[model samples]
Target: MIRPNMERPTMKRREFLATTTALGALTLVTPGRLLAETPVAGGTLVWGHSETTQNLDMHQTGTASTSRVLQNIHNALVTVNSDMEVVPQLAESYEVSDDGLEYTFRLRAGVMFHDGSTLTSEDVKYSFERCADPETGATNFEVFNDVAGIETPDELTVIVRMTRPNAPFLARLAENGAGVVMPAGSGDIQGTTPVGAGPFRFIRREFGNEVVLERFDDYWDGPAHLERIIAREITEPTVRLTGLRTGELHMINDIPAERVAEVEGDASLQVLTWFPLNFDFLNFNHDLELFQDARVRRAFDLMIDKEMLLQGALWGQGETTASASFPNDAARNTDITQRGQDIAAARALLSEAGHPPGSLNVVFKVTTNYPYHVESAQIIAEWAREAGVNMTIEQLTWADWLSQVWVDRDFQMTMMNFFTIWEPDRLYFSLWHSTGGFNYRNINVPEIDALAEEARGTIDADARNALYRRIQDMVSEEALDVILWFRNGSIGARSEVAGLDTLVHPNGSNLNFHKVWLRS
Candidate 1:
């Protein structure tokens, strides 16, 4: 049995100190700028971000773009605060039994949904059951599968019995997709027309254009200070910057690092930067015969230079690591051998694997949604070619890529930026665990699967960290995926926009519209 590493009790919190410290320094508004401005209760806040698929059903489609909109339109049972602590949202309070198997939640009284339906324990049961159901196709089905049974003793109380102890259950509840709570039996919620009990109410949506939300006066916490919130789909970063300059958009996400100084120089705009809990990587389709050999994967990893990729493609906006685990965690074992650009060694490995000089062809897939992806792909292809690997680049639209690569899983390799949950253990489960919904790589190492299962049940943080360390070492040695870099995120917003930058969570629910108000 694994033992908890109690020597560093507060290590997890301190692991994020550097990143959080930088965020504190970067998110400051122009001095004395907003001091005289009082938050007013009326104007509509118009925000813009990159466009992705829209499945209005928050539970069904867990895309980051859709979750940003849903964060306001619906409230989860729990939420991570600005400090990154998981706290109850819809649930007034909760309790767990000694065995860590049974959890009871008390629903907050008098909370109202958009349709005037009162929040009740039944709604909680229905929402969770639906997520656990295979037919619902909930993105978080695997996460919610621990629910052995749920019992509603009364209108205001819900008791959940887990099949096994799950340390990250509450943290999972705070995630973007799993946190959302819809009315019981609200059949097939659409993105265009949503019925949520959040501070914002769904008004309308024009696909490829914008999604509009209005304030819900009956919100349990309090009605949103703004009368309305509009999330406009702006695909081009330059156009978004122009929108910010012309005052067409009040806030925008993902301003390229090259433009950071320009946005910060403008007195009317403030740049909010933070080291987001996300990383870009190249995922290998292990089912492909070419990648079936671990030796070939290691060869592919050694040929690429992560530093060049970050500098040339990302404009030095991120940090690189060899570990599959989140680098911010202290539990991440840094003792593992680091792989760097070694063309000769890579070529030797490839040759030893029976593939010599241009004998193998590999397709590299990427989407044009983020310019960095295409740039990185080009650089990676060049590096691979140096080792005599004939790499071909394939560009697809975001939607098309999602269908073919994510859903159909018919590709050799693809590049993507994925987010990590606040619950560190869930990150491992989501990527390495066999049942992990996002484990598109189809990695099925028996030892890794056993560790993932053990990690979930191990409540002691230290022991969990130990298991994760071993897991990371295994993944790194096998070169399961190439973890390129950890990204730095920024939101470009008008000086008048207040509270928009206060809620930055790793799960991509950065926009907290309820707390945002226009300064007068």
Candidate 2:
């Protein structure tokens, strides 16, 4: 991870206020002018996002860009702090039953939706039920599948009973799909019109160009400092960096690794780095005969040099992955180190698996959005060829690749990344479960299914952690997936920007906008 020297001098409050006041007067001031005039109250913050969200339905969409947008317009029952701790949002306090099957939440009083409707337990119930509905197209239905029922004793109290003990229930509530809470009886109007109690209220969206959000005056926490926010979709990485440098954008997400040095060297911009709880890995088609053999999978893992990929292709922006997921994860197995590059061992293993020459026809498919993905695929293909494996590379548009290569399972292997949060139950269970939607036809392991089930059924943190370690070890030894690397988080902001906190979970839903203010 890139570490910035924290001891470097920062502008003091008095200097910041004076500068902001001058800038605010020179520039057109709006509702959030306090962020400019007072240097703390508020100002509009323009953010350039790298990708456009496919859908606005928070429950249905799984992309991080969409989640960031949703987080601004919708507030969950709970929120995750910068320190990766779960905190109360709409709910003031919560209590868990001794058996760990029931959760009771007391709502914060006087919270109201943008429509001037007061929040109640009924809204919370409808929100969860809508999320649990299959027809709702909620991408994270698996997280709430164990819910037996939801009960509201009063307007401010919500009780939830689960079919089994779940230790990560609160963490799941802070996740992408579960973070959005809609008004009661508003199920039919979700995608068309969404109303929530977040700092910003949705105005309108123009596909592929921008999404407009206006600050809510009656926000429970306090009035947002920013009068307005415009999320622009700028797909090019270089264009994003240039925009930040030129002051065309207040902030830009997902800065390119190659331009990090250049951007940091510029006096007009400041670069922030955070270690995200996310990783990318290679998924093998286990149903395919060639990949069904554990020996063949192990041979493929030994062929690629992870360190070279991280340093050369990734530009030293990532950590070599030992398992299919992040090592810092609570469920990760610390005992197993990643297999180093050993071409000889790979060749021998391939021969033992009946591929005498260690060469087999393989295809690598990747999406075009993340240029590094295609680059990584090419590097891996070259390494495989050197290790006596015949490989073909194919690049496809994001939509086509998702539908054909990934969902359709038409390729021998594919490169994909999971933007994970703090909860491994959802991360591991969704990726490795026998019936997991993201399993992508590679769910043939009964042992993994059992382990994941056991982990989900336990409420104790230590027991659940032990279960995760076992799962990691099992997948690593079996070569279920060839883990590549865990990516680092990078963002470019103008020098005048402040309060931009570090991101612990790199799921793209950054939450510091509420505290961020512009220095005049």
TM-score of each: 0.93, 0.86
Name the runs in model 1 displaced over 4 angstroms: 1-15, 18-26, 29-37, 190-192, 506-509
Alpha carbon lDDT at 154, candidate 2: 99
- lDDT (10s digit) by residue, model 2, range 1-520: 1111111111122332243221211111122223433436667788888777666777876666677787777888986654445668898887777677888888999898987889999999999998888888677777787899999999999999989776677777876778567888776766756678888898988877888888888999987767778888887788887787788899887788777667767666766654442478877888899899989889888988888988776787767767654334445677887788998899889988888664488888887767788888888888888778888888876667767765578878888877744467766777788766567747577888888888777756677778878877877888888777777666777866666642223333354465566775
Evaluate residue 516 in candidate 2 and report its C-alpha lDDT on the 0 to 100 scale.
63
Residue 490: error of model 2 in Å?
1.1
In candidate 2 the C-alpha lDDT for residue 137 amounts to 67
Clash count, one per candidate: 2, 6
Worst 10 residues of 2 by lDDT: 1-10
